[model samples]
Target: MSETIRRHPEAATLMSYAAGTLCEPLAAVVTAHLSMCEDCRHEVEDLELIGAGLLGSLAPAVGPAIRIPKRPLECEALTDAPVVERRRPDHLPAPIAQVYGLGFDTIPWKRLGPGVWHHRLELSAGVEGDLRLLKIGPGREMPDHGHGGSELTLVLDGAYADETGEYRRGDLQDADEDVEHRPVADKIVGCVCLIASERPARFKSIVGKLLQPWTGM
Candidate 1:
């Protein structure tokens, strides 16, 4: 899967994730990509090690002494207990599956337009961002648009192509405010993507703009 993944999040984006600085929505997209791309997983691991070393080298800040709380001796008995792993759907990434909590085929898709469907994911209260799963019908083309802020898209299934290039399963496309393109779904398989954006998209077409309030893209 890593070998076939030609697209990946930018180095800066990975660094932010490694440093634990990315917001929940953006981090979710990166986490999904990392699950399928071995190369990216390794990259993030290396980045984390580097971050740890840097933190270790920094001078410790002077602060008030912290108190430790005592726990019952029985609490230690659970130390040797086997861990129970949560099962997830094979087709969906772990992060997405955890949030969606449903099979891909069972998604209650809301129509965005003729051939585009989306299901928005909920974020914590007061969280400022957008995250959703987009399902595009075969040969469908999205409206031309530019991002208002940063946007990260992870291909969960099939493929899509834009001015940048083609993105297939396990591929991640990182776009910012300056990027403007119309993405077209694959003719045969169409596309299913997990998208996270810092702000709403800026549509080039009036029709797209008019629908933005309803679609919440």
Candidate 2:
């Protein structure tokens, strides 16, 4: 079970998703999980209802019925296209290859170093902060570096471990500034995760500085 997964899901993200206050990429991941985890979906919906109810309870004499401007939609489509036929057989188990359309369009995969795949998602809609996806191959560990901001991970496929045990699909990790873990992708199948962080990675290894142009990226 992914229950023992380290860290905690960002309460803000959860609340935002519930209130429909997040962008497409994060919302897409949450929606996929909601398709399986009714609890989270309901939680989000409940938050939405609460927000609506609060607005409704406001002074009715305040304003007129606002018309939504169609051509002026606040959100933009995702830039990174996901083409891999990835599978997640845990939890609700989704064929991620097909469902990415719920969020991403397929694009050619980038070979970021050996066995590392990176896809950048352009932010749209109610999104906040810098978010990206990092795909690591089996037995590979990212260069040891400390974080500059809050880092959150949602494991979509395979497993990985830090000082903690393995994390499978549906595992969510929130790495704060105080926590520094050199997580290594399990030597089984690589690990794919949705990582949303506040700042760029700060290199801690000499090799990290040497590869700063590549690593800091």
- Highest lDDT: which candidate? 1
1-217 per-residue lDDT for model 2 (tens digits)? 3344343356787776655555444454555445445455456666666776788854222111111111222323323544344342343223232333322224345677778787754555554555556789999997776677666667766788886566776676656677777778979887877666566667787866676576334
List residue ranges in candidate 2 displaced over 4 A. 1-8, 19-36, 57-107, 125-129, 215-217
Worst 10 residues of 2 by lDDT: 62-71
Error of 1 at 45 (Å): 0.9
For all candidates, what are the clash counts?
A: 0, 4
Give the Å error, residue 156, model 1. Answer: 1.2
- For each candidate, what is the lDDT? 0.79, 0.57
- Residue-by-residue lDDT tens digits, candidate 1, 59-93: 33221111011123332454565443434345677
Candidate 1, residue 123: lDDT? 72
